[model samples]
Target chain A: MDAKTFFIYLLVMAGTTYLVRAVPFALVKEKISNPLIKSFLYYIPYAVLTAMTIPAIFTCTGSYISAALGFAAAVILSLLGQGLMTVSMLACLTVFVSELLIR
Target chain B: MHFYKKGLAAGIPIALGYLSVSFTFGIIAVSEGFSWWQAVLISMTCLTSAGQFSGIHTMLIPGAYLDMLLSQFTINIRYSFMSVSLSQKADDRLRGIWRWIFGFFITDEIFAVGVTEDSVSRSYMAGLSTLPYLGWTGGTLLGALFGSILPERIMVALSIAIYGMFVAIVVPELKKNRDVILVVAVAAAASCVMTYVPGLSRLSPGISISIASVVAALVGALIHPVREEAAEDGC
Candidate 1:
């Protein structure tokens, strides 16, 4: 991308991102009127993360084997109540090692 | 002072996370025909992983301004939802007027930290954002400068950092909270069904991800029914 064009592009993207984040607070405060709407907001994080992570685990390369290792690793590590750092390192190690062994 | 500490604490993990990922982006952007300053500017200004990823994907495709806008819109529109939800968490004071200042730095990592942290001063939240904001932008500048020199094998290993971070976030939540577990399961099921079943409107990765998340959130709220008192229990 041209230097000038790319810079402008970045500004626009940044502008939109900033607007999206700031706009909500501009209108709404702590007292949300509707309970159902408030309840739905509470669940958004878990749902968004699940949607992102699960398919990613199952659908990477190596057919069933790769998916199996990642899925097994996440479930096992989480079940063991591992901290975030530990679980991620374990998952990354499992995927890396399994990919190497399979190759 | 407390806000400063929280910002520093939150920024450490975030800075660590941004360094490798932004470095990769720097290297890739240079290779993909973006200028070094352009690479740095994009990372600094946008502070989004998927947005830049998709930006480059379409930049390679020989498109016009409209195409660029559409591509960016599709990938990054999810942040709007996150931003709106997070707005609720912001303190209603002079700091509220400065929402735009801190909101610009609202990435997936920042949002996770913001919501999880107990209610604190708005100045602190903004401070929290500033630490990562600087690291994220600064890391990309350095990475764009040094990244082109790294070997392919080493780079691939480093590329796994974001995935590693994702595991860090999700694994812990899944363990302690059944509400979190249910939400994740439902979101996954929704995404899967949407992908496989095929009658629904065609959705991009960004939209699919966002919609599934909202669906899961709505479901979790419906099922668990958070009490006002309970919200303060854990934090």
Candidate 2:
């Protein structure tokens, strides 16, 4: 895509995403009262994060074993109550070391 | 002022985490022929990883504007769900133009942090968004500019950071609550099936995530409905 075409298409992508968020967020002023709906909303963040992570995480580093090593390291460190930055950086390091071993 | 300070503090972890992820995004965008300025522009104007990937992929197809539009919607549809959730979490001060403006800044990470708050004001939201936005944009500029300089192995390894962050977010909560454990397991299992199954695997990642998470969360909500008393000032 040329510069001009890229610029317009970028707007299309950005516009769609922004509107998707802005519309509901701006319009939904009333509190949703249904217990079921509330529960669903409460669970949405966890569910989305999990669904996006699994399987994807395993293949993230482009090597099955290395990515799995990263995954294991992340879960272990997190379970042991480490902070987000620590777990993430260490997981990357695990993948780096494990990739060398695999090679 | 205190709220903004709290927001800035909260954003640090997310900013640290974003540096790598957006850095990867930068490399990919530049490698795919985008100029550093263009790549930074995309990052500046967008907040989603998957959607940006789809956008760049669409650029490869000549005259695929409609394709880009539709895919971005589906890929980013989760933000709408998150926006709805955040709408409920916003304080009285956050309304009208405030919601419209700040809502555009909402992403998975921001929403994740937002819902943890009892309420959000525009100032706090501004502080919350500031560093992560800069991290994303700045990281992209560096990556696009230095992409060819980085070793392939290092880039590949650094790619794991975001997922590791996700695991870190979910695991402690999973350990503390059985309901969370079940929800995560069901979502992960469903995600695996969608990823590996022949026909199902063809679906876009966003659609797959949407389906897997909504179904699992549905099961959770049915099994353990949040008490209505949790809602404040029901009128």
Candidate 3:
């Protein structure tokens, strides 16, 4: 895409994303009364984060072995109980460096 | 008074996270043949790691428009989850018009920090989000513009940014539960199971991560169910 087209592309994409993000805030800030819904909402981040990160561990290369090892590295470090920053960095380092050395 | 300081504090982690992740995104975009500007647009507009990744993947494939739309929605539906969570955190005093304004900047990291913030005021969350938002956009622009000129080793090191931030967040939380050995055992075992099972081994990273998180969270909540009786009036 050229400069003009790409700019427009970004504008549209950003606009769409912002709209998706912004609309719920406009519509639902006052209506949430049920405690269960509120409680469920609190857990959404954990679900989303896990969903995004764990699978990446196993499936990045369409291979079970590397992904399993990567997942193991992340889980063990995260469980052995580093902070989020440590866990992520260690996992990435382990995966990237391992791949570099092994492959 | 304290708001500005808190905002800056929150922004620091965000800026760190944004710089690393957006830089990676920039590299991915450029390597895929997109222009520097295109990369910036992706970061600025999408403001999401997975969404952008999925978008790039779709762009490479030969597919129907319906398939593209479905894929984007599936990946991005999570943002709506964040929005729902923030609705509970936002104050009743917040006006209708400004509600969406604050919500617009609610990425996963921002939502995480906001929900855990000492106060859930709109100003606090907005202030917290401002730096990360700017850093993310700016970092993407920088990465795209300078990606070629930079040495490969430097770029490689930059990829560690998000992982570093995640470590920072998880480490303290794990430490605080001070002796909640069960979480450690459960989380580790679950991670292993999620990693090795044959049927699950075929799923996408996004779904796998989601399942793992849900399992972990359930384990967490089960271990310490919400003390609704103890919840404060506003909370």
Candidate 4:
């Protein structure tokens, strides 16, 4: 793409992204009172994170076995209260080693 | 100042995670004909993985402008819900211009951290956001400049670290709350069905995730309403 068109594409992409993020913050100034809505919001973080993690995780690495090993390592380390970096690094290491062994 | 420090501390893992993923993005962007600086610019401005990847594909394939716009909107609209949920958690002292300024940084990882906080302040959010922003853009620049230099195995390993980070964030909560387990299970099941089922498998990642989350959360809320007494007790 040319410079002009690239610039326009960036502008539109940035604008749409910012709008989606900003509009809710601008509009929802007051606390939500409804029990159902509040509960739904409360559960969103866990629900979204879970949905994003699974199925996708299995496909992340070259082989499903390596990915599953990484995921299992992650869960165990995290449950042991390791820091995020630690858990991630260890899990990656597990995937690396497991991939080599599997091959 | 204390809260800012805490936020930065909390953000360290997120920044590190971003570094690896955005590095991969940088490699792809450069191969797609973007200059190193252009790829960095995309990361700095967009800060979204799926949307930018899709945007680049649309651009490279000579798609119409409307198609690019629609694809970006569809991929990123989840942020709207996340932002609204976070607005309820932010400290009341955070007002006016700060909201818009900080809202720009409300990516999924940041939103997850922010919503889990007991009380979120503007400075805390700013400190939390700045490092990951730098990591993303900086990693992109490096990746574009040094495309494919890393060994395949190492790159594959680094690529999966972000998922590890996500698991780290959610597993603790899942352990503490039975309701959380239920919500996660429902969402996971819904996502699996949407992903693997014959007809439903055609749904895009964004739409499938959104549907699974909303439906699961709604089911959770109906089945396990937080009683007024329990809510007050926690607060």
Candidate 5:
């Protein structure tokens, strides 16, 4: 894409994203009383994050083995109450070493 | 002031995580033909990993403007849910311009942290979000500038860190809450089906993720509606 087209794409994408995030905050001035809607909202974060992670995670690396090892490391570290940075770094390090070894 | 300080402290981990993840995104964006400045601009404006990744894919394929807009909207609509949920928790003092300002930074991680607070203040949310914002944009600049110089294996490994960060965020919640596990499983299954099930596999990643998350959350809500008492306990 040309520079002009790229900037337009950026603007449109950014505008759409900002509207999604901002509209809700703009409109919802009161507490939601409906249990089902409330429940759905409550579950959204977990559902969305989980959906974003899996299947995709396994395919992000050069090798599935390295990705799987990285995932495993992340899970174990998180379970042990490690912070996000620590878990991510260790997992990345694991993937780096494992990929080298596998090669 | 105290809350602002607390928010900054809490945001440190998120900022660090974002730096690494956006570093990977910067590399990908450059590889996909974005200039370093363009990648940084996208990170600064978009402030979303999945949506931007999908956007870059759409751009690389020469997709239509509507296609890009629709994809971004689909990937980002969850933030609307988060924003509405958080609006209830925000302090009454945060109104008008303040609400809109902080709302701009309401990513999944920011929303997660913000909504858990007893009462979210404008200053505190600003402090909480600003660092991650800087980290994301700054990391993009670095990655886009130096990505070609980085080793192939190192770049590949750093790419995994984004997923690792996602796993780190969700596993602890899944362990504590059966409802979370159920929702996660449902969403994951839905995602896999959309990805691998012949005809359904044709659907774009943005649409598939949007459908899976909404449908999974709906099922979870139907099966496990939160009691008023439990909702109160959460706050």
Candidate 6:
């Protein structure tokens, strides 16, 4: 990446992220009373995470089988109420082992 | 207890957890052709996993500036909610322009830990955030600089760590929040459509993800308008 292009794009990424965090913290003191708006914000995290993860996660690894194994492990561990670190590690381990076997 | 000391102690678990995720971020970002500094710069500049990864994915797609702007705003808009809630928890020390500086540090983990306290001071917030921030940035540095030495198998496995993290975050919530399960499914389906559809595939991933997130969240908001009492209960 050209240094300039990379820097400009990063500024865009960092700048928007900062504003989203900073504007509300610095300016908003009262509760957001609008239930509709509140609901939108509330669901934004889950919606965004799911959209980014699906389809993309399937193709992240070298093979679909390994990625599926990892994805399954992640979901099961998470559903079992495991922590982020535990779920991530175990999922990766599943892929690592499965990929080795598949190869 | 000294405020910073107490905060540092409280922050250890979050720091350790960050080490794992950000390490994976480092390896994948570098492997994806980002320079070591570029990856570290991202970790330092944006203390978020989903947003950072989404940013890189958008950039790699060479998405338009408009796409980049909208996608980042959509993915990270959740932070505004967290920061707004934390504003109620902040002490006088986190006042004035310093709120901007302090606000930059409010990741999901930090917000979870910070809100449990009666009131958070600049010192306490600083102490709490310092280690996790450093752990995140430093882990990225290590992963970017040295991650290549690991066997390709391990690296391949590591590639999916961030997505695993996303699943970990969303799955537990989905199990408990029946409404969110449908909302997530809706968003995922929307994303898949954009990916697999012929003409729609030409739309940048940034635009596609943003549109999907917004549409699904809108559906969620419309379906469950978060009654006033429920909204209050959240705060």
Best by lDDT: 6
Model 1 residue A86 CA deviation (Å) reads 5.1
**What does candidate 4 score on TM?**
0.81
- Assess the local accuracy of residue B113 in candidate 3 as a C-alpha lDDT between 0 and 100: 71
User: What TM-score does chain A of each model score against the native chain A?
Assistant: 0.70, 0.79, 0.62, 0.78, 0.90, 0.94
Per-model clash counts, in order, read 3, 0, 22, 0, 0, 0
Which 10 consecutive residues of model 5 chain B have the lowest summed lDDT? Answer: B226-235
Which run of 10 residues does model 4 chain B get worst, by summed lDDT?
B226-235
Which portions of model 6 show Cα errors greater than 4 Å?
B61-63, B227-235
* Every candidate's chain B TM-score: 0.72, 0.81, 0.70, 0.73, 0.91, 0.88
Q: Please write out the lDDT profile of model 5 over residues B1-235, one tens digit for every residue.
A: 8878888987887898888888889999999888999999999988997788778877765647887877788778778878887888889888788887888899878887887789989878988998999989998998899988999989888888777877887788777666777888999999998888999888777777878888888998899987774443221
Cα lDDT, all candidates:
0.62, 0.82, 0.59, 0.79, 0.84, 0.85
Candidate that would win on TM-score: 5
lDDT of 2 by residue, A32-81 (tens): 77888777766766787788898898877778999988999999999999
Please list the residue runs of candidate 2 whose C-alpha ends up more than 4 Å from where it truly belongs after superposition.
Answer: B53-55, B58-71, B228-235
Task: Give the candidate order by descending TM-score.
Answer: 5, 6, 2, 4, 1, 3
By how many angstroms RMSD does model 2 differ from the true structure? Answer: 3.3
Report the lDDT tens digits of candidate 6 across residue range B53-142: 778877775545677888888778878888887888888778888898899998877886897788889889889999999989988998
TM-score of every candidate relative to the true structure: 0.75, 0.87, 0.69, 0.81, 0.94, 0.93
Please estimate how well model 6 matches the true structure, expressed as its whole-model Cα lDDT: 0.85
lDDT of 1 at B15: 69
What does DockQ come to for candidate 3?
A: 0.28
Q: Tens-digit lDDT track for model 5 on A1-103?
A: 7998888889999999998998788778987899998788677766776777878988989589999999999999999998778998899999999998999
In candidate 6, the residue pairs with backbone N, CA or C atoms under 3 Å apart (3 or more residues apart, or in different chains) clash, namely: none
Show the lowest summed lDDT stretch of 10 residues, model 3 chain A: A39-48
Q: Rank by DockQ, descending?
A: 6, 5, 2, 4, 1, 3
The better-scoring model by TM-score among 3 and 5 is 5
User: Regarding DockQ, does 2 or 4 come out ahead?
Assistant: 2
Query: What DockQ does candidate 1 score?
Result: 0.43
